[model samples]
Target: MTVDLIAVVPRNSRGRGVQRYYDAQSECAFFVSEPSGQPELWHRYLDGARDVYRRFGVEQALEYDAVADGASTSLFFAALNADGDMVAGTRIQGPYTDARQAHALVEWAGRAGADDLRRMIADRIPYGVIEAKGAWVARDAAHRAELGAAISRTVLHGARLLGARYGLATVASFTVPRHEACGAMPAERIPAVPYPDERYRTVPLWWDTRGYSAFAEESQRFSTQAEQDALGLTAVRPLDARCGAGRAAESRRGHGR
Candidate 1:
């Protein structure tokens, strides 16, 4: 629950060389790894997400099997307390080759803004796009807001590590401002969607990795830059060459979207 955080440090090399960092502000240790390769950690993340989603009465929105398979997840982030319980987490889905590959597009299908959502993702595909999903924090955790903010910053961290220039998220209206503090902007032109039975108005949010620093809060900017520096990334690299080449071919075939 504390906000006076320490520097990011790698605590161990277990779980297929899982990376760990400390957040003094939140009083928690954060872990990053590939989902499929770390079965124990992967299950911990799934369980934590499921518990939080169920508490919010939006458990139906989660696709358990799809998430469990871990085939599409490129990076997973988890936060644990001193006692070693998973407290907060999120996963990055892809530097996708197709717009339809995003769960948001699937959730928007048959809806009014479906096309707009597709186009939004398609336009960013060539620049490297990733969907940050399954984000959650335990309700009983101390310093909930601070912890949540810390988790939000990981979206940018994960995107940069994966060579992604843009990241997308479909978050409930209430959490919009929290994400925005970390540089996510709502797609205001598109109307909100009533998802998981209408109790929630979910809207699409995007982060332009190249310029998020200009919009992020000062503390957030400092924290993000510190984390990136710890990872040895002096600057944001361009989209991975493989992703660029593949997208070019996909665009030529009119399948980029």
Candidate 2:
């Protein structure tokens, strides 16, 4: 049920530029990079995410400007076709110090379930929490479902790599099943919010990195575990120096997660 086709290839001598993950079964290559480490690819990811958001009529919700410089992002994940065109991607933000740091707090502000959403994040912050955002897939990409599954696995891989105990994602109602397959559970106690407009009902989902296998689908369990194992051997680079300093300062201020 699991394919052992994912391999990580370092894209730079210093191990800081980009790390490529090639999935032979899908013939799709996934790249993980920091904005400062590989600006070009980082921009590609931003552009791709923007395009997807625009087409979905949720561009405003994306808050592109806020993440353009990638100061708030810990890592970027891009999935490219064999022809080298990016088809899907997502980004990781945090290991947050406070519940208010989650984008959901802002999105749910003055809306239904805002308080419960805040509580959910606050409870996880002490365990180390990261948010997976800007996730998208090209409309015309082949094997879209398979690619989506791969991207979900990246959430697990990323959370583990970043030392996060939990991961958060706010997704449209329809996408909940896909994420759930990869061990993301909806915060059902908090009513779903009509975000970016009433056209969609968005719900907050959480991934307990330490116990995901208990809920993840069989194939996902094997594949995510395989990918996480592979990532363990890869030398993922640290955040940009300025970003590192900022994190240090936040920690010193007693805001560390």
Looking at model 2, report the run of 10 residues with the lowest lDDT sum. 1-10
Indicate the residue-level lDDT of 163 in model 1.
90
Q: What TM-score would every model get versus the actual structure? A: 0.85, 0.83
Put down candidate 1 lDDT per residue, 73-189, tens digits, no spaces: 899998877767779999998989999899998778889888988888988889898888899999999879989898888888888888988888898889988987887777646
User: Candidate 2's residue-wise lDDT over 1-257, tens digit each?
Assistant: 22222332324423465666565545677778777886767788889989999998899987899899999999888887766677889999987998988998887899888887887788777778899889989999988998888887777777776788778888889988998888777775778888879999988888766556555688887777666655654433322334555653442232112
Deviation from native of the Cα of residue 135 in model 2, angstroms: 0.5
Deviation of model 1 at 184, angstroms: 0.7
Quote the lDDT for 172 in model 1.
87
> Who wins the TM-score comparison?
1
Candidate 2 achieves a global lDDT of 0.75
Backbone clashes in each candidate structure, one number apiece? 5, 0
